[model samples]
Target: LQLNVFCQTKPTIEASTNIQFSCIQIHYDGLDKQMTAARLNLLNNYWDVVHDFSADESPVANYTLLYEEKAVQLQSAAVFQNSSVTFERSKSTVLSTGNLLSENINQVAILFCQVDNESIVDDPKEPLLMILDIYRQLNVSFVKTVQTPVDAATMRNFVNPRWKGSSKSKAVMAIFIWNCTDNEQNFFNKAISSNNWVGKVNLKVGSDAMDVIDEVYKIIDSNRS
Candidate 1:
């Protein structure tokens, strides 16, 4: 007596799991019903993939064979206050939540907190790459405050050196600390609105870090093309 077995195509994507097996009848003719009945033996027995299921044993199999599989979804975010400081977001602030080495990220935001011109030159590369995120993925950077907004020529020169990667590639947003009393902060607002901002980038000004971050979330969560 011979038994025929067949298997169907299995999933290959990293997300797929679980395989189902079914019993298929092949012999329906005058193959003696008693003979088929005898094939059914003990209810439980040791089973092996290769012997029982005739599964593919080749090393270079096309489908993924999971011995033990587990799935867990993880949320991640990186934030930097300054070169050395890192501010934690409040749970109320973050609905969910890296040098974020992926500068080719979909969006980029340059944040202007209070700053003196001295540290701008020596700012670590890590902080520039790292950023705060509770919603969508984007890059955030900090810049030195100037007393007055930069002109078109200055905007081209001033924004690039501090910004890594292609300036025009990713969507850029500039967020500055805007207070009527602070001259530098006032200028920071105007700097972001230069021709550089119009259609290519987003500009937001707020009184404090939390306020700026809140606007950041709005921009990131928005669906404006």
Candidate 2:
């Protein structure tokens, strides 16, 4: 028997600021009835009678081997059927409960299954890989927040080396702000449109730190292009 499982968040919005997500499970049973019956007895004494007839080891037994084999086959079928039914029913409940917290935050979440990279000879570039590469180049100390929204003031404070450390200890930080309101979006658009952001790569002081930032922007550009 082989089992495959996967989980991931979905991309759908709800209310003013909510999103939805899912998870999936797959299984494959490859053993024949005779093989399965034999294994069952090997693993436990409870199936001794079934295995004895299936393996033709007890020819002198009063009961017919065909009848005993049929009974054991039915039992195995019933076990697999019951397990599959329970699993499908439980899946819905699990997904609902797991994402309940997100509901309050106006978001829906799910676990998704994807193909393993090892299984494929040729794999395309993805945003996740880009993010991972950028993460490796970045200094750990500079990571103040992760996957959270921030205001303009917070952004300014994060970028200012003087506020957090001395010139020698300063590190370049990247902040990801999300779940912004319409007003916030407008503000960002206006700021960028008016060229208010410096948008300059400052490598004079923190050359190594700025290199990481440059790599991150390059990834962003590649993703967009």
Winning candidate number (lDDT) = 1
Off by over 4 Å in 2: 1-127, 135-145, 160-225
Candidate 1 residues 121-222, lDDT tens each? 233112222222211122222221111212233233433334322322222232322222355434434543532332333233332333434443454335
How high is the lDDT of residue 53 in model 1? 32
Candidate 2 residue lDDT tens string, 187-219:
433433343223421111133333433443454
TM-score of 1: 0.17
For residue 150, give model 2's deviation from the true position in Å: 0.4
- In candidate 1, clashing pairs total 0
For model 1, what is the C-alpha lDDT against the true structure?
Answer: 0.27
Highest TM-score among the candidates is held by which one?
1
Query: Roughly what TM-score does model 2 have, to 2 decimal places?
Result: 0.16
Error of 1 at 70 (Å): 41
Which 10 consecutive residues of model 2 have the lowest summed lDDT? 64-73
| CA displacement after TM-score superposition, residue 110 of candidate 2 (Å) | 29
